[model samples]
Target: MDKHTIMQYFEWYLPADSQHWKRLAEDAEHLSQIGIGMVWMPPAFKATGLNDVGYGIYDLYDLGEFDQKGTIPTKYGTKDDYLEAIQALKQHGIRPIADIVLNHKAGGDELETFQVRKMNPTNRQEALSEPYEIQGWTGFTFPGRQKQYSDFNWHWYHFDGLDYDALHEETGIYQIVGDNKGWADQNQVDTENGNYDYLMFDDIDFKHPDVVAHLKEWAQWFLETTGVTGFRLDAVKHISEDFMADFIAYAKTLQPELYAFGEFWKDDIDTTLRYLDGTNYQYDLVDVGLHMNLYQASQNGADYDLTTIFDGSLVQIKPQSSVTFVENHDTQAGQALQSKVEDWFKPIAYGLILLRQEGLPCVFYGDYYGIEGDFAQPSFQEDLDKLLYLRQHYVYGQQTDYFDHPNCIAWTQSGDEEHPQSLAVVLSNSEAGWKRLDMGTLNAGKTFVDYLGRCADKIVIEEDGWASFPVQGGSISAWIEESI
Candidate 1:
């Protein structure tokens, strides 16, 4: 966790204005000043259209460079604008983490007649249709790009399957079956549908040597061209675990210290851990289980056990590799998969992720800045910022957790020698409560103030180093040893 804080640079419905890169570049200094060490930018490569949100990737070599998809730039900005933004962020001392969507590709140049077989929706291993010629959108000539970066071209041979048949106007999961051509083994995934590898569009066949080769080549070029220091892999569950491990190994040749993570997005921690193990622990994963716990706590409130917050969570198991977050683009209001943590409990969730010294915390853009969509959600910027401020300036020490209570949990961090300010964090899902805990003999008579303003008072420690700290109902309080 070299960079303690990271920001998912874009949300799902970020305005299709080409000036997003410019604004981000300008805000680099401001973000760094506010303790954001890195930004995980959306995919910079040219997508299907200017409105694709950078996920429906077309040409990896095309980073809004050529006149592809009737636009010179992607949803964010042009290639030059993207490079400038990365440079600007670098100037402000923030490492830009590029989004790598290697799992699948979409928006082909045209349809090609290819032999394919439909896999059963419930069981992908069971084929319902025989291999037959069908017109599918797998041709990606990238005419606009003119193969500028790499001469490698994508055709039906490059992919293992296509989901949609344009001639028939039908959609079905088709696996390109042959001696070795087909969807990557679904056995590696954990799902009721046997495997969830086929998420959207033309899924890439990682088993193919050419596909893997092109990906590795493009990664090198992307690093050299954009100078991104890290990566945020998209839809990694669809790709082979071994391929991901090899990709990281190959990428490290260019950037040895590259901080990379994948969106495994599992319901349980076991699957995520298995994926990490399968990849030989090459990168970290998003702590989705913690997010689910937060959502449950928001729903159940006092009924939810406060002590079980870290149960079945990556942060509790492997603290260092766990990138913790409250809500991201997917969990925002009215997204593809919406499970918004209640606004009332947002501060509490942020407090938990930021105050505790476990995982690398990622503050979502939608959370920091009010979400923009059909229904706008209130921003918890102020509360989250203060916690981040403490994280940057005052959060340093040996942690002591008091998770005995069901509705309330408290912790005290013995101040490190570097910073003489110890922190005591307390929260409750139910009602107002107080914790009389020892913050170590280092502070016997020091006074502590709740920066959250929940208590509206400061408590002085007694001679034995114990003090009664209070918090409001359904709220969290972070007490800092008040500056003497």
Candidate 2:
């Protein structure tokens, strides 16, 4: 069908060596074989140090080529090595979705310009303007007592500490406090008014015209060079809503069909929909909050009953808007399909998402074959291939109808207008080995087959048009009528 398929890449997956590049290319091939139409690679731009997670960027143009241990990977060959991976994916009909980090930067007053301003010994106002803060979530504990910008040492500015005000234009240095050394690190600025530090890494003054231009430049380059299908804008909430509108508008000029989605972390429907209104929502957001409900129900041994999540107030959104995902890098790892409780839970979860009407469905790499690692693992090509085949033939590009019952939750997906035959899925949330479902209006006296297990069963529709059958042990499926 016309469903948008995406594969998420964790930050730790990108290797720093040539051997790693080869392995990554092979992984891309595996995903394409499994019917994945798009791949979202983690951030690969330049960074300050060994940031296994690439959110902390150092330069926009540099593609992490300092060294294997360092950000750059000349050791991994050259920039060409990276491009080869992208091209290889394209050959397999998979589009690349680059994860852009436009939020914050690393802190250290090592650059000469920033250090001069911090130690200005003269006017301190100019020093406070430097990009001083690190993004909040890194788990560093900065001393609360060192409040003044001058009192703190700049070298101590690590991933754990945040310095919100550290810019000094007079000295052209980013003034950051050091914890142990009692000195400030001086940072140099490449742009006029020492604005590069603010624009490239830290939260930029989004209202500034220059900031808008800088973002546009990156978008243009990305579209022109990589031919990426879309972007997963990182930290979009931190930027002003107005700036997002303007930036997306400019990006359209480069590729009119380019899809862009923002990461707005919230579970409530109203709160999530608020960000989607009045903006260029070509591809708006992923209903993470709704996914959470389904995930919780699965984990709680509710047998993947997805009624509460699907039956919630329907969000009136563009057909291809929101991106739906069960579990991502930030959330708890999805349950292993090998585990009895989790095995049936995943397929049922995918059933709910892929058969839904609102957004495109995303399948986490780990969910395919129950990989247990945090980030990278060997490919699950066999399982993924079968699942994708089923998704493309059955659920993808289909119109969905949702139904709910106290004992079970089910949905019907029909082919497009031209081909209307449909598949119905009913999931039982009981752990007593099996549960019976009354199929209302489902055709009776026809042979039905479970595609996953290749099991065949007869559907005997009663006089009341109800079909009763014991759902396969700990599993869900696409039940197709033999007559149709």
Candidate 3:
């Protein structure tokens, strides 16, 4: 089997014209030709409205099928459109991955009075007020659909906490006070801000047996309905670790080969590793630590040490379970986690992630199709295609690394028996430099050239199958045989 690359198929600021699914269907063949094995699609269910990016989920059963949230279609499109997109992707040999937001639910249909205590937002372990009755938007009747799929009516008891008190017209993190109600155990979630369970809207209490059973049933229904081969679990750090493991396990029972990954979103490697361990390695995790390193390197430029790039990265610690990414919807400009990688270092960052044989690399949609909204940017498709082509063709076999420099580093791939290809990649963050790397003594006099067209140098290998590969300052150059 050939190597697989995952593409995050949606950006944060996509136009709400309800044509995303159609667009995806049209581009399915192109994506398959580019060697994309999987596509992480945005949330297809009905959210607050057409403007909502599907994160503020209103009803999981309504996949743009019912007349809820003031619209019959989601930000993407109708349920039929979504299923057609999935069929198109599958027809093109691509596995469509559904983005599942099981952390919280937004845009409830009604308000209900419930007793709660306001907790400190910074430290959720500390209560700021005594238990009091407050009307909150914790009632979700789904009146528009009239419970078509499931007769599950969400009440205050279904949630552990909420943000707004509708009765007092106040805004705060209010934890519902009742029998066995509170945040998940500290060990089950990240230790940031005391407890990071309550992120936004009505936090789903995973301990509720009904909630678990319903979610499991919904997973089975979703699999049968959409035929998605995988899931991109969102905001997993704010959810119960055990529940997450169980959810992935349960989903796999319905579809055993279902690929699953989570968004831990922690810059600390220890936290990420701990989460992976806590979940019993049931699913892979996005390497947020590596992204932070890339961001810092982009910001610091030449001053940054290239040798320590993957020092604390999940790819370095747990390569088998790390989903390496350059940028995503959350890391794009104007988003909450606004740490957009600098434009100048984007190619270098992408080269490091795409060409290396470490973790599973993911391509961002914003970088390929260009971002929309206030901070729009042009597409980097041309340069990315070059790297993607090389990744699909030549990035195979045993790997070699040369990280002895502060700015310039190089690596080589001794092509396997089936794929008789060789690649030598060199990158420099400071000044132009060259590295004499050994590509094995199989082809002593083969000519090589820069595939990226950055440097117009063509050199023949020596008797020992070693050549000096050149790279321009602040750029990357991938060298391959000229006669391939």
Candidate 4:
């Protein structure tokens, strides 16, 4: 069976040319051929404007279908273009995943006077001032859409907070005053900033029945309209866990086998696990701890303990419910969560995720295709392609781990009946090193070579099916049986 690999197809600094959908459609076949089983497309909904990157959501109903947000087409393309891209991906046997941003709403149509209390930015639970009237952009009429899909006009009652006070021409965390309206419970959201329920923009009040109903309605419409097989939920740690669990459950009723994962963005494995539990394991979580480990290893270089790479990682404890990635749009340079793994460690990081049989690994588009903005970086396409090829063809069977060394680690996969192509992987963070690891006892005396072509010398397995695999300093090598 082929390994399931996911590719995040968009980056933070992509060109604002509205050709991303077309580019994805054009590259569908190539993506499939390169063993990408799933592709996570950027937010299809219209954002604040042309170059908003879809995070600052404006109109959920207007997916480039209306002239809202000052443009007929989104940063990617039009609605027709997005649907065509989905079809193209499906035709190529790739599951398309949509990015869902439900934590807040932005680009409201008009300002509305509402009663609010300024909350302490450091401690959201603390009210800094008494209730006062202020005009906020909490009215989202979506006039450009003209009530096309749904006529659910958002008002101040549907949200709990906002960052800007248009009436006062000032900025502060203003908690909207209403009955049963406040941030989610301390236990329901992240512990950061006292209570993390208030992220940015107009924070949706999950406790409100109208807000919950409309969100559910929109989710169903999004699924049926897009035909996407999965979703990549954004900022889950800030949203109410109960609502998320209920939403995911409701979504599963429509598509029983829907693949859902959230960006918790918490480096603490226990907190992430608590979220998974809180949501009743309704969806998987991105292994932020593992990503941090990779980033630290990259930064510390040889000083980092290679043997403890997976220590305290979600993948280490709950592999089945973890979505592993080296770097992502949020973690890329110049972003809020900019803990990027260095260039030299990318190959090693990719090797750890791609060649392993643990978590479902995801490749970042920025790393594979290169970043294209002020904090631009070169692409690792060549090395990533090689690792991906090895994963698709050579990686198989029972695994053996050799993580005794602090700087050098190695593992091997014993061939199975269907796939006889066994593989051995060796990596070193310090100086050059070699590990005498056993591939298997079957068919000894066979010759093996480094598929990465980093090492020129070949090694012949002994009668015991053991050979010393060599790798260069700060590099990784995947050794496989030489082709006949």
Per-model TM values vs. the true structure: 0.97, 0.71, 0.99, 0.99
Candidate 2 residues 37-101, lDDT tens each?
88776665655555345666544544544342343443223455667767877888788777777
- TM-score between candidate 3 and the true structure: 0.99
Model 1: lDDT equals: 0.85
Over 4 Å off, model 3: none
- Pairs of residues at least 3 apart in sequence or in different chains that clash in candidate 3: none
For each of the candidates, give the backbone clash count.
Answer: 0, 30, 0, 0
**Per-residue lDDT value at 230 in model 4:** 96
lDDT at residue 219 of model 4 (Cα atoms): 84
Candidates' C-alpha lDDT: 0.85, 0.52, 0.92, 0.92
What lDDT score goes with residue 100 in model 3?
A: 98
* Model 4 alpha-carbon miss at residue 382, Å: 1.3
Residue by residue across 1-484, what tens digits does model 1's lDDT show? 2237999988888889898999899999989888899899988888889998888888899888899988998999988899999999999889899999887788898888878898898877778988877788888888887878888877787777678977788899888766688666765555547667677888887888888888888888889888999999887787788888999989999998898988888868888888888998899998989999999999999999999999999999988779998888788877776889999999999888888789999999988988766868877788877988878866677889889899989998776767668889999999899888888777888899998888888899989889888989999999987773
Model 4 regions lying over 4 Å from their true place:
none
RMSD of each: 1.4, 10.4, 0.8, 0.9
